[model samples]
Target: MQHQAFLDLRTTLDLLKANGELSEVSGEVNWDVELGAVTREVLRRRGPALLFSNITGYRGPQARCSRLATGLFASFRRISLMLGFDQQPSNRALIEYVLKKNATLVPPVLVEDGPVHENVLTGDAVDLFAFPAPRWHHLDGGRYIGTMGCVVTRDPQTRQVNVGLYRSMIVDRNRMGTLIVSSQGWGGHWGKYREMKRPMPVAFVFGWDPVMEFVAGSPIPATICEYDVMGGYRGAPVPLVKCRTVELEVPAAAELVVEGTISDDPATYAPEGPFGEYTGHVSEIATPRPVVKVSAITHRDRPIFRGTLEGSLPGASGENSYMSSIQRAAIACNVLRNAGIPGILDVFVHPVNNGTTVIVQIKKHYEGQPKQIAAALWGSNASSHRYKFVVVVDDDIDPGDYEAVDWAINYRVDPGSDDIVVFRSTFGSALDPSTLLEHRQLSELGAGLWNRMLIDATRTWRFPRRPQWGGERFPPLVTPRPQDLELVRKRWREYGFAGWKAEF
Candidate 1:
């Protein structure tokens, strides 16, 4: 991996542009309507994101700016680059990188000032509306500004840093209604402070390297601080600067920084959502979330507005953001390895409704053994407790290859013998539709256990058999000739493949 220090959002935009991953537009775009519509249309076509240069209703001369560059992490090639791996490295390779670097914790460095501190707007002068906030969906309650930003908070007792990528909806210029699922680590920290009747400090950072954005979404264990993990992911200490108005440190090169205090009181319930969640559905959750009375808003000159959609479509809540799913699978695989599972070749958790559903696969070692392995997988620290469904398969099956896993599921396993539903022990996410019940039903159920179904999709047998793994016993490997691939690259136009030409 190379060290590419981005000085500002413009530099990050330029890098995306130079890599042919950005779309440029010169028309007049509106933050309230046009920006959201265009992004939806582009994501529908699975097209590159556009940067809208001229937004409507500007105080100064109609400024040249662009929006929506590299939405949904766009490409696997880019994901691998972001993770510091080869173009097409396997999940195993990714896990190796994580384990190798996790021990050498690279602490973040503090700086006096960076791009984020360039133009500080303190107290009443700070207006979040000055920037273009996108109203992504028609049914969305409000325009969201921090879809791609990292919310930085720390434990009130331990002071362990927690970073999460939660949405920030613009309520007014000075106030944004943040969605906090209090069960989550970051939210739990705020809940603890709220119990003690103390204000929780928070700093949200927009527009840093995409790697930081990814880390913001990662499930870094409670013991390890995300800032340290961000440092590991970057292969260098992330440069952070202390906020002038809040007790928080933000990325020095962040395009925009928001500093505020979270009011920790359930009595202050705000009518939060009808906004689209990661699942393609619109749901309402009433929680006493942090009402950030913005102490300050800081940014560099001409800071680019960065965003992503989150409602059940590609680039929003869709499969377009497969990198995180892939990363989650990698994390699960690591957990299994730590548990001494053998013949674990690969794993993949695919997004259904884009990212709401998870399908996990593990290589089968022995006949009828896949059942035991499948059940044990539910105990794995990374995914077992949380995933909706987990399927176990043989090495003959490619977990990441959706087609192969489907074939195994259809032809091999009989549900009567292979499918087993374990009760009372599992936990699930709030986004799960089946878990939430009516108030009357809740009285009977008493907070239901999220029942996850694990289908032992690997081949079942009548008798014990040897594991079909190792050297030549593994499935025949296939790869295109380097010369042939190069030839196809040069002659792709003649072969009627336009996308390839654009890709190359």
Candidate 2:
């Protein structure tokens, strides 16, 4: 069982293709809307990861970067592959793996040079449109180049670095419009810079090991740098190179790197979004957002531009959803552990909502355990946009089974009793469509307000135990005895059910 990281995007793509998990398009596709539509359609069909080699206006010999790769981590099978698992691992297995890795810290090592510096463009040579920046949605404000890119920043006082996934739209040839909420990882760095009245140096890293994206997008502790966690995933020191124009370091093998600075000055603000977010809906309309003024652009020789469609649909999703399913659940469980809350057996996040709702299976330890779970999850910085709905079930229930969770909710949860809990006006995702526009205004509120809900699906312990209840607070479920089930299993073949297998 050797688990290692795919050091570069090329190797990762090759492995995906060899595994029959990636599909390449040789035909030319328009970058305007066609490319995004194709990617979305593939996700809808649960098809292979995509590689568009022939995009319109990007096929000429002089093209800087022609190929585009998206949806590489859109499925559990692909994600398992990224984690070095030959066969698709179970959800529980992946969650446990992520939990351990998230806690491990292997600091990155500095490298004087690498592939990212093969070509460096500064001042007039830098062009944001040189690579294909897809207009993922027709209603989108503009082409977003940093949808899946990692944004690197550092705290002014402690100088503790943070790598986060923040959306960026091409504002001009050397400027990008971005929505930086004060509640996010990078937002905290921006605030420290703001207090100092100094522009924040920033770098955007694209296309390296997918582990960079995996760790950067997660809600790891503020004290631990994501590069360290990424190193833990790789089982080696992550080699990083200093950015030309920023005080941050990026993966040495990253396909492309953009270095720049962001200031709070109104002059640096530009009209930014209405982007199709991971919430499956467009957020606030185009508004003045802090913009990154590019001072330098660096890349590998004939770099492969990496980008992904951001929105998640009913039957379709992308890398963010798949990655979050494991990361969010593990992070939540870690939060519970830190709070000293016991009885947590399993945590599950359905890809559809990307952890907006979570299900936790636990052994009943106390009457108010469900409330404790909700409080601990909400209190954590990781819950800024997650764990909005927490459902706690008994050990007998499986969190992954929606029907089982639903049944538990219906039978065990009494709406008017303490079984249901709601935490109002808590910090949450500004992009949640359900959140009122006024609540999402970043200018006023630092974060969105969510009325969080907790459905205690476990059986109530307040009831007195009777002779028929077998000394238990709650009545026993109407299930066949273990010996009775064994008898049925043995006689199932003799009872004219030879073709069917009894799994229970």
Question: Local distance difference test, per candidate?
Answer: 0.64, 0.91
Compute the lDDT for candidate 1: 0.64
Query: Compared with the true structure, what per-residue lDDT tens digits does model 1 show for residues 346-463?
Result: 6666643332334445455655565455555556434422555667777777776778888877866667764544444364455555565342122133222466676767655553
Worst 10 residues of 1 by lDDT: 439-448
lDDT of 2 by residue, 231-253 (tens): 99888899999888788899999
Model 1 CA deviation exceeding 4 Å by range:
1-8, 58-72, 81-104, 285-288, 314-320, 351-363, 366-377, 384-386, 422-425, 437-449, 461-504
- Which candidate tops lDDT? 2
TM-score of each: 0.81, 0.96
